[model samples]
Target: MRAIATPGGLPISDPAALVDVEVEAPQALPHDLVVRVEAVSVNPVDSKVRLSANPSDTPRILGYDAAGTVTAVGQEVSGFAVGDEVYYAGAIDRPGSNADYQAVDHRIAAHKPTTLSFADAAALPLTALTAMEALEDLFHVGANSEGTLLVLGGAGGVGSIMIQLAKRLTSLRVIATASRPETAAWAREMGADEVANHHDLGAEVLRIVPEGVDYVLSTHSEGQIGAFAEIVKPLGHIAAIDDGNLNLSPLKPKRISWHWEFMFSRSLFQTPDIAVQGRMLADLATMVDAGEIRTTATQYIEDFTAAGIREAHRRIESHGTQGKIVVTR
Candidate 1:
């Protein structure tokens, strides 16, 4: 089978030499579904890993989000068949989806939305799961709300979905941060109640959530989080996808809670609740089919290859995309 993998530590945006290799085909494992990848979406982590993660032993396939067809299933699998189209963000601990065919645990697999193209479905898994986990699992804000949640970097993939989810599932006033005018507009389209500049987070958030906000979800955990500590309500929660060495002392007075949403924790640890992803995916499919949810895909390119994958990575690195970028096979 063909795969785009990194055999050495290198930057993306020119993965032609890094990717584009022929590898042996994968075999099915118990409770695993072998998918013939039809589409895959790029995320920030893909670039970070391609540049930073060390794969000393062998080539590392580095993609998590994909939409494809189940060509084969392990003996223990029951919900899908050989021809059933599926979609999922493959587990972080295992091989990724930047390949001709890949194997994923049954638990993390979700049916593609009946109304969406493969590219659209590919964009949802990682972002939707992250957003859902940040609210429903980490903060206990599901189906009920006492205060508003401010989303930082709300024009990106996870943030875009988070804005819509808060609107769909909770009554929380959705305040989002976007530094650019186009991004601010994108955030609003995704259902942000208000948009503010991320550069002046404290002042901008104060204008919308005057009494401070209930939670802050940052897509990029860049620097000086303490500088905006005043904006979070006392006993509020903070969730983030990006993690760097940083201090948390300023949040002490507010009794602020912190959550790191990896989105791959269950699969990485093989947790007892690994099946939750599958259930969540099924629910999202249902939501899409019922017109309760919509795809966040911004760019949908065709085929899975070196040039296309490189372009997707470049788009993400440019940090200008308002929504998801997907490439189909």
Candidate 2:
């Protein structure tokens, strides 16, 4: 099987950082699906792993988001079959989706949306799963929930889906943060009720919701923990995906509840309820088919070459892309 991998951790700017290689095809485990990968999407996790995690003697594959057709299934796999088309963000502990074939746990894989192409479907899994878990699991948001929610990094891949899910699935008044006009417009296009500049987030949000937002989901909450504390309402829920040293001192008075949403958590740990991710993807597919949600694939890499993968990583690391980037074979 043809694949892309990194032999050692190196900066993205290194000309030889990512390379093409030929590797053995993966076989299905007892509960796995061996997928013939057609398309893969790049995310921030790819770059982070590439830069930080040391690769084994066999080069390490770095993609997590993929849409493909199941070529074979393990004995215990029940929800999917050999001919099924599926999309999933593979477990971080396993070899990734950047290859011609990958073995994914069927519990976290769902049938691809019929309305979308392989590339478009590939773009949704990782980001959509993260967004869904953040809102529905960590924040406990429901269709009847009523509150003002602020989303940081509103136009990025996860935030793009977050905006849509909040609008379509819940009654939360959505406010998103984007620094540029184009990104702000994109957030609004994704169904955000309002968009504010992240650079002046406190003021921008305060101007619109004077009492402060009831919930804050900071997708890239690295240095703005204090800023979030200042803008969130008392007893509100604050969730984030980024890992950093956070000081909860300021939020004590407000009684804020902090949560972290790592989409890979269930699969990474082989949790008993890992199948929930597959079920959520199925739900997302229904919403997409019903026209309540849209694909976030704004950037497309025409070919699945090594150079193309490098370019996709560059765009994701730049942190300026408005939506997801997909590379197709």
Candidate 3:
């Protein structure tokens, strides 16, 4: 099998950051699927791991989002077969999808959306799961949910899908934050009812909804916690996916609750309900096929080699990409 991997903690500009190597094919473990990877997408976690994970004698594979065909299934797997087409964000503890073949736990994998191509399907798994879990599992928003919801960093992969999911699944009025005109337009295209400038988050959101919003989804929460506290209504909820040294005192006075959403937590911990990821993904596929949701793949790269993976990492590190970037074999 051909794979691309990082030597460890090297800058993207270094040619050694990602390298092409030939490796033995993986075999399915009990409750796992050995997939022949067709397409993969790069996420911020890929870059973070590349820089922070320890150096190893054997280079580490870093991709997470993948769409592929199952070449073999574990003895205990029931829903998938050898010929099934599946998509998933493979567990962070395992070797990743930037390879010709990968072994992933079948409990977290689902059949790809029938309406999308491999490139498009590859872009949905990680981001869609994050959005779905944050909205439904964390915030507990549903069809009966009402009030305004604000989405921070609305043009990025997770935010793009979050906007669409919130609109289709809940009655909450959606406000997405985007500093650039192009990103603002993209946010609206994804079903945001209003667009606020992320550069001036508090003022922008206040102008649109003077009473403050009921919920806040912070995709990039580095330095905006204060603004989030200011714009959220009392007793409202805020769910964030990024890691930062956050100060919670600001939200304390307002009685606003803050929650952290890490999509990899369930798979990483082997939770009892780990199969919910597969189930949610299956539901998302049905929605995609029904035209209720759309893929967020804005940029596509056809090369699945080391150089291509490096370029994809560079783009993700740029911090300005509008949607998901897919690299197909």
What is the total number of backbone clashes in candidate 1? 1
TM, every model: 0.96, 0.98, 0.98
lDDT of 2 by residue, 1-329 (tens): 88899876888898667889998999889999999999999999999898887756777887899999999999998978788999999999898888889999999999999999999999999999998998888888899999999999999998999999999888999999998899999999999999888887888899999889998888777667777788899899998888888777888898999998899999988888999999999999999888888999999998787788999999988877999999998
| Model 2 lowest lDDT segment of ten | 219-228
Clashes of 3: 0
Best by lDDT: 3
Question: Candidate 3, which ten residues in sequence have the lowest lDDT sum?
Answer: 219-228
lDDT of 3 by residue, 226-303 (tens): 897889999999998888888888899889999999999999999999999999899999999999999999999989
Query: How high is the lDDT of residue 282 in model 1?
Result: 91
TM-score: which is higher, 2 or 3? 3
- Candidate 2 regions exceeding 4 Å error are none
Name the better of 2 and 3 by lDDT: 3
Q: Compare candidates 1 and 3 on lDDT and give the better one.
A: 3
Minimal lDDT window, size 10, model 1: 8-17
User: On a 0 to 100 scale, what is the lDDT of residue 227 in model 1?
Assistant: 48
| Model 2 clashing residue pairs (backbone) | none
**Which residue segments of model 1 deviate by more than 4 Å?**
13-17, 55-57
Decide which is better by lDDT, 1 or 2.
2
